[model samples]
Target: MRFNKELKNIKIYEAGKPIELVVREFGIDEKDIVKLASNENPYGTSPKVVEAVKLVVDKMSLYPDDSMFELKKGLSNKFKVKSENIIIGAGSDQILEFACRAVLNDNTKVLMNKITFAMYEIYALQQGAKVLKTRCYRHDLDEFYDIYKKASPDIVFICSPNNPTGDALGKEYIYTFLEKVKEPLVIVDGAYMEYAGYKDEKKRVEPKDLIDKFENVLYLGTFSKAYGLGGLRVGYGIANEEIIKNLYKLRPPFNITTLSLKAAVEALKDEDFVNDSVKRNFTQMERYVNFAIQRGFEYIDSYTNFITYIFPKEVSSKELSNRLLQRGIIVRDLTGYGMNALRITIGTKEQNDKFFEKFKEVLNGY
Candidate 1:
């Protein structure tokens, strides 16, 4: 059997290790594992979403509403955009795939920060498109513009509150950059925008405002982050009607499950639950910041649910992460991303306390 040449080089994304996997491997009780790897809402989904899913579980045998009217309507109302400007996907990543498919061809090129979301390059490669990246690890619009002019890429990705290293670009700065680049499709992945918005008002990227200002821009959003619906996998893309229409051409019917649609719609209704969750995230996040400071470790000021702590040359992040894992704690080791760092999701107060205790022992070589 022959595989596509692109498939040979594509590295599979390794998601955070599940608690059950840790239990089986290290003989730890499931209850004893503290998972702070994936940037999931420490508190699970809203009660309303849970109840909504319960009512729809019996309908799993039936296909979901292919039109996705209710969820689109809820998103339209919340974001103040027309329903025609939206397209639902299994997750925001699927919508990203759609965008890549719609614009990219074998000869096409896409630009992104060197260390943004891995999926951006992965999806572009599936279309056989060339990937160009900025020299800096963080989002540098000036560098992006310089490359954009020379390469004339078909798409440019801006992952604000960028993953792994949790810094973000202000919307105003992004808008200025958008003004300069008019032809290419600029994809702004706001997967962690809710947490960024809650942390600082200036970091918020209003989809309605963005799409209204630029026809070529697509804003990707997700319920997986702050809404606590990661398990259900609900995400959407917001853009102009034309962009939405082209993306819909590639969208398969019933891509999202019946329960996911119901849960996302319910998640939208209870803004209080979302807001409270964001508030608690930042509150717990401060402890992680303080821990890093007191330990003389350098860390990024995060706008997302997770914080990245960069270890010095002498300390091995891989060794520390392994030690933590053996103690029934799971945090992301950034060695795969080529950084001597660990990206840890800010968990609940008790969970964080356990991490701090275990992390300290590992740091002290216990």
Candidate 2:
């Protein structure tokens, strides 16, 4: 059978190589692998979340609450938004798919930067729509504003502490952009909000600050990054009642697992766990910064747990990444993002130390 016309052109997303795979392929001990590719909480999940998951394991045969009342209520209380304004997804990425279905079609276009999250383009294109992107490396809202008028896109994506790159969009810039572009639906991907906010709460584009002000803007948040629930795949979106209402229709029944839903509820209660992870990541990122400086490596300024270090022209990113992988360490290769760099997630102190030891040895060889 033939697929939808656009399905053939859509490329599947390439996730980071898993640690289990590394062990299986190279015959290394499972304990020796250091996975710094995905921006996961190396410190692990909250004890509260673990207990919640255990309590719900017996209910796996049962369906999760389709309404997601407790999760939404929890989010509502935390973000200070009404439950009607929040929509849950398997992950924030799934909510993004819902957003594309709500706004994009053959006649519409999605606007974003050339170097933001790749999923924005993937989702837009999958909806059989066009994607218009900005022209620079810097996440400048001014250029986005100029392009918005010309492109007249149906949806706009702004990824803060943007993935793979780690540069955050400033709050003042977001205010200006919202003031200028009031027509299109703007989705701010704040997947790293907790970590970015910890760095300087004043500088980040807070979703709570905007839900009351702009009907056209939607905030995308996830549990995968900071909460250490990447394996469970639960995330959410915040917007006006009308936008949430439209996006909700497209969601499938029993979309989230009971374990994930219950675990996130507990994760929300454990703010101290989130805060400690943020503090540790911040300190480790500074350590990585010093390493880059002392070794003369070009690196991107990061506000999240991951730091993108650009390789010297003399070195190949793929080769360097392969070199690290052989040593039981893994990092994200930036070739897909059109950069000669590696995005390394700042892990726990011991994990970070191992990554650095291998990194130094690899660099010395080059």
Candidate 3:
């Protein structure tokens, strides 16, 4: 049997080790581990979603709605877009993979910023697509413009409040790019948009608004972050109905689980929960940012739930991360992202405080 050559070269994503795994490895108690990794909501799933999931658990024997009818209807009502324009998935990660499979061929090249999500490159390689990585830390629009002008790729992935960097590209820059790039499909990955703190401002631009204006633009959103449904693995994409129709061709039957659909439907209905999560996340992030600055730490002003901070020149990110682990604090080391930085997810107030205390102790010892 012959295997695809692309599969051999693909590097797997190294997710943060589970608390139990870390505890076993370090001989630490599980309760002691403060996981500030994976950017998960420390508050856990909403009460409404928990109730919904419990209600649906008895129906596990039944297959889920392959079309995700109720979930799509809820999302449609929430976003004020037609149900046909939305495509539900196990997670936005799966939606991204479906997009790659639907649109990319061996001849296709995928374009993304230097420090964007790792999944983009993984999915591209899996589909035997060549990836053109542009050099930009914070989605530099000029660099993107130049690359778009030179080589028109099959797809361009843009992550606002980008992973690892925690910086967002301005709305003007995105609009300008949309105006210039007419050929390739543009994916605006807004997985962390709820934590982005720009919803009410005039400068805020929801990529969904561009669907009617730009045929090739796709907006990816997830229930994982603000909705506290990361464990449920549910997300969606918004696009022109035509593009959504094409993407749906790649989706498998019963792609979303039954409980996930139920929980997501209920979660979407709880507007107050979404608002509260965003508000709390913003407050926690603000405190961390202020603490980092007052302590003379070098970091970017972040719009997302996580903050990426550069360790002191002498301390490698790996060493710092290991020390953090020994203290039972799991923060992400960005060595894989090609930068000597550490990405710490904003946790609950108590969790964040514990992490800060440990972080400061680690710095002092160094």
Candidate 4:
């Protein structure tokens, strides 16, 4: 049987290389490999979440709380929104799917920047929808204004602290833009917003702040980043109740596992753990940015856990990525994103040193 034509264009996602793969490829010990890809919190999960997981470990024979009652309540308490306004998924990526499946289709279109998250394009194409990417590197509201109105997209995605390029949108800019467009639903992917303002909550704009003002908007978040729970894959979406109610129908009954549910709920309660992770990430990311500047290497000022640096014309990102990998340092290659950059996750101090020693070696030898 022939597959749907949409499958022809949908490319498989290229994830960061696992530590095991690196160890096996280069004959290096697992411990010697430094993984500065995927933007995972190198710090272990919160102590509270560990305890919560152990408590649920004994109940693996049974199914998870399909309704996600406690997790929703915990999120509500933390974000100061009603429980009904929240939806949990295996990861925020899955929540993204639910959103697309609920609204996007063959006839509609979606909007994002030229180099935002690749998943937005993958999901939209999977549903046979057209993706209206902005002309510039960043999705400047002013630039998208006329083009967006002309296209009349069904949905718009704002990947604040955009992937591959970590620049974020300003609050006033978004508010003013919102005033102009009142039709299409806007979904803000704030996966890394916490890291952008690691020490200051006021620096990050919450989706709750916009929901009441704008009737057609949803906020997607992931516990994988700040919570140190990427292995568990817990994520959430917050929006107006009416939009939430419709999206809920697309959710599978037991999408989130029991351990993940427990970890995410406890993670929400222990905001201090997340804060510490963000604080440390910010400190480390700053050093990398400075190092890039001193070396005269072009790089983006990251608001997230990872920084993307453009290699000089002499060395392609492929060559840089290859050199780092030979030394057991795994970072993201941006070829798939159509960028001449290499993205490095801001790991701990020691880990950062390991990358630098090898990265400098690559540049020096070149």
lDDT of each candidate versus the true structure: 0.93, 0.89, 0.86, 0.87
Q: Candidate 3 residues 63-118, lDDT tens each? A: 98887888889888877889999999899999999999998888989899998899
Most accurate candidate by lDDT: 1
User: Which residue window of length 10 is worst by lDDT in model 1?
Assistant: 357-366
Best by TM-score: 1
Using Cα atoms with residue i matched to residue i, what is each candidate's TM-score against the true structure? 0.99, 0.98, 0.97, 0.97
* Model 2 residue 258 distance off true place after TM-score fit, in angstroms: 0.6
Q: Number of clashes in every candidate structure?
A: 0, 0, 0, 0
**Candidate order, lDDT descending:** 1, 2, 4, 3
What would you estimate as the lDDT of candidate 1?
0.93
Candidate 2 colliding pairs = none
Candidate 3: misplaced stretches above 4 Å?
Answer: 198-203
Q: State, as a TM-score between 0 and 1, how close model 1 is to the true structure.
A: 0.99
Give lDDT: candidate 2, residue 323. 94
Which regions of candidate 4 deviate over 4 angstroms?
Answer: 199-203
lDDT of 1 by residue, 1-366 (tens): 998887777889889899999999999999999999999899998998888789989999999889989999999999999999999998899999999989998899999998878899899998899999988988999999999999999999999989979999998999999999999999999999998998899999999999989999999999999999888888999999999999999999899999998999899999999999999999998998898889889999999999999988889999989999999999999998889999999999999999999988987774
**On a 0 to 100 scale, what is the lDDT of residue 236 in model 2?**
98
